[model samples]
Target: MDTPQPKQLSPRRRRALIFASLAVAVIVGTSLYYLHPIGILAPKATAQAASTTLFSKPDTLVSYNFESAQLGWALAVTETRLNQGPFWIFRTVDGAKHWQRQLVGQTSSLFLTLASFQFLDPTHGFVAVGNPISLYRTTDGGMHWLALGLPYADGYAVTFTDPLHGWFLAWPHLWSTSDGGNTWNQLPDPPVDSTPLFLEFDKWNNLVFRSRLEGWLGSNGAGQPHVYSSADGGHSWQRREVPLPSGAVASGTLRTGVQALPGAGVIASVNPSTSPNALFTSFDGGTSWSEVTPLPIGGGTGDLGFQDNLHWWEIYVGALYMSSDGGQTWNHISDELPSAVSSLHILDSQHAWAQMFFAEGSVLAFTADGGLHWTRANAPQPT
Candidate 1:
């Protein structure tokens, strides 16, 4: 007897069943990007040793962390040749003088190493990478990596308040690791469903951990706009009602762009769906919020970065703005943003670095005189 073939759906039906998902990267370190071979602009700073090559081709870079002038990490994935291609990491030390690459894939695979990476310091870090998606830790500043032996979980976003205490998040579930990710235990949560109430399509993913027990969750895909504060790590939550923008019928929540500042303050950009063209600040840890002055940029704060509570930067469509008195007023730091900066790690009022998107690819950029001058930096690559 001949074997039978599986049934096939019609083209119209197949098309109707298709769906798409956006990959988000929530990095808990400090990092950004730029690649150059003597770029159109000359080198302006001497802190960077030399511009280096991270990958030979274009790739997706996410979960960036630049903890200091000499420490940073990020996940770089290339889908150019998918199964037969390479998935590598981007690491820099020695002040971006030379970058070392660690390959994660020997052959092609559909899996991403992890959704994001959290590095507490130059010597300790954690990431969720593997076929079934497992957690890994690096103690020697990512020079070598090992698995935590934790059970397979879909966790892609993680945050750490210290070297040994952190939180892991997947949708609808939150886990805690007190032993530096060697083990993880599921934490208690509110009676709400798996999805978060607010939403953002990017990696900011609406999550920030202020302490071992206090954290802020921005939005999820399946709910209304509401910011949830978890005082007991993820055990339970209290809703901090936010004021809706003027002319808005109702207030909603957003995923990315929720920034936690010193002294239990939070600055968040209101989603257009929730309100429209406004940012808010909360002094009482989201118990209540007040609309601040509009930012200098006439756009959303998708790629917002902060040097501190009083100093800020907003990156959108190649434009960057700096604010001093909250968002009441902003200074156009860079008339033309080098690229969409993922995060800006300001070493001081002058020295800073950023991981960003440029020409549809990942690259590194740095500054020595605030935002006035920028020089492309290098990323990690193979030895």
Candidate 2:
């Protein structure tokens, strides 16, 4: 018998059959893959680089020395003489890389004097200006600052524990504000004989009230720095004497900046004296204090900020020093920076920012590896 001849389907039917078979195979393959999954994609690597870059070069203003405040955000203040007018406030939200100048009407003189600044949050803060304490409040961050008048004009240190409660130390007394700096009430004059020129709040409700209370007062003012503790807010205070180290004398005056470790009941204060760079720590919540070994460059007027309860750092003569053992010992970390630093701030144990003031003006520097290496940030111009 001859080979059976197979009948071919129509061309259209053959094409349709081929397409339908392909569609069926694709559908089955998709369904099976979805139903029973297998490793189809490559795995991503978990090991990351040792150090990550957080900020690049910063553009800083002309003023080498300015104040910085840290709440949820960081803020710096600068002054410039633009056409013989007062310097406007230039602020940066992105860690000082860029800044925006605030326009808050013209003052009698273009010379704006920002004495002190404190922020309860990134948005809410107070800025003190002039001989008479003219307090300004900003609810919408630092974009705009509105005046909140306090009777005391010459305010030194301003602090806010929360949005509702804040304090400012003028020459003779301490002022408290509970209504987000809307109004102020003076606390009974602090227990010290002379006016309390400087003060700081410890986490344990202890006030490191300084000035004539512990140091010298009047024209020939110069005395040993004394620390006072107030358990019941500012109602009462107990004097705590910080013992000087074995060789140093307790003759030097305490500086304005005071930092307290609230969790560890440790307080750090700058003592500018004839002795070695003096620093003090109080373990008993300001009731008692002990002197910490000094840093290399001696302490400057800038404040000391603690990285943690154990590590403390200070800025002096454009260099940074760190103490790992609760201020007992210190190591110089200045060589890691590019320029001489004016102010130093520690956001946490790992992150820190320093404003370097050099002959070429100022530059903002940030370090992610705990001050090991620093990179510049773009600073804002003062309006």
Candidate 3:
């Protein structure tokens, strides 16, 4: 029985075998790392609500959305840890008065700079994080989060109309999910110029859908805006050449913003250089476009919020402006606002929220009285 030992190799051959094994390990590890860069372990990551009592506000507020005045969620950086993510979500049931620590990423060494969150209702929502982007979905609010296994390594934004129907953007590639983020299929690319469309990474609102079959996609910071409309839910698209207003000298790369109105309409904002931006509307679901009115070039016209066809809100030069006559005329409303706002969400005629950045820190301002007054939930400095 002792004579059954395995043969040993020469010293040189043993060293060569060892080196070969190490090379294989290196190749496999690198491939896995590329698949999930920056430690974005989404396949098995579990998100749970954090219990640590940090400051009153978050450190760095990245994204936030609310279904109602009372029910809302905010994603921010609270701490500097890997196992318990610095990216934390805070929820407010009684409006923005007091926010509770709702959830935290459990992935080790997870890193991201920008993030976007949208809540379709109080129960269903999605969050997309950038910098080796990943998407997560929660059906029972933020109580539990399941990492969506997106086929692409990078995701710019995500929008969900219902619990099952949603759209994802990985640059020029657009993917649609019908199984509540469980499975996805890539949609055909629009015939429009993909070069400028690919450069719209900062503008997340460019890709929008009103329903399962209706959607609008546009590009900004690209020369002369290129917008497209789809009636069959992005299976096919038609390019819309938006016309500039008369006597307006087009300068700089065109910055465009598009919003899908509920039902059969869409609105677009075209800002040519430093001139006043113009608003356009299409009643036949982006089939035909017409300019409505010109808004004063106070701030940039990138942020446009509409409660309905006629009621719209815009933050211009630290002031709130409203247009009831379908953006035909603008009226200023007295309110305390910042010179710039990162994001604006208008729930109705009265209830609205804005995320503002200050030299002190970022603050989430809420207005219940239609921009007449505001109460800010100040974010503490990042730890």
Best by TM-score: 1
For model 3, residues 1-383, the per-residue Cα lDDT tens digits are: 11121234343533322222111110000111112222133444343333322223423334566788878776654323421234556666766555655555422212122323668888887765433345677766666566667767654456777888888766667889889888989998655453233322334234677888887776555555647778888899877767775556666677666777655577776767766667688787555777776556643453567778778887764667888977778887864665543356789889898765433334566788998887765332222
Strongest candidate by lDDT: 3
CA error at residue 379 for candidate 1, angstroms:
3.5
Q: What does candidate 1's lDDT look like per residue over 133-158, in tens digits?
A: 54566666665666565443443355
User: What ranking of all candidate models by lDDT puts the best one first?
Assistant: 3, 1, 2
Candidate 2: give its CA RMSD in angstroms: 26.0
Two-way lDDT contest, 1 vs 2, winner: 1
Summarize candidate 2's per-residue lDDT along 1-383 as a digit string, tens digits.
Answer: 02221233343533332222111110000100011001112133121111112221122123222224221222222322221123334445455544544432222111122223445455666555433335666666555456667756444346566667766665458777778678887877665443433221111122333321221111111455555555555655655555544465555354322344634554544344564445566666656667666565534323366677777777654456788887777787755553243356677766876654433344556777777777666654432
lDDT score of residue 55 within candidate 2: 23
TM-score for each of the candidates: 0.74, 0.63, 0.74
The reply for model 1, stretches above 4 Å from the true place, is 1-51, 54-56, 80-86, 106-114, 190-201, 220-224, 251-257, 274-277, 297-302, 339-343, 381-383
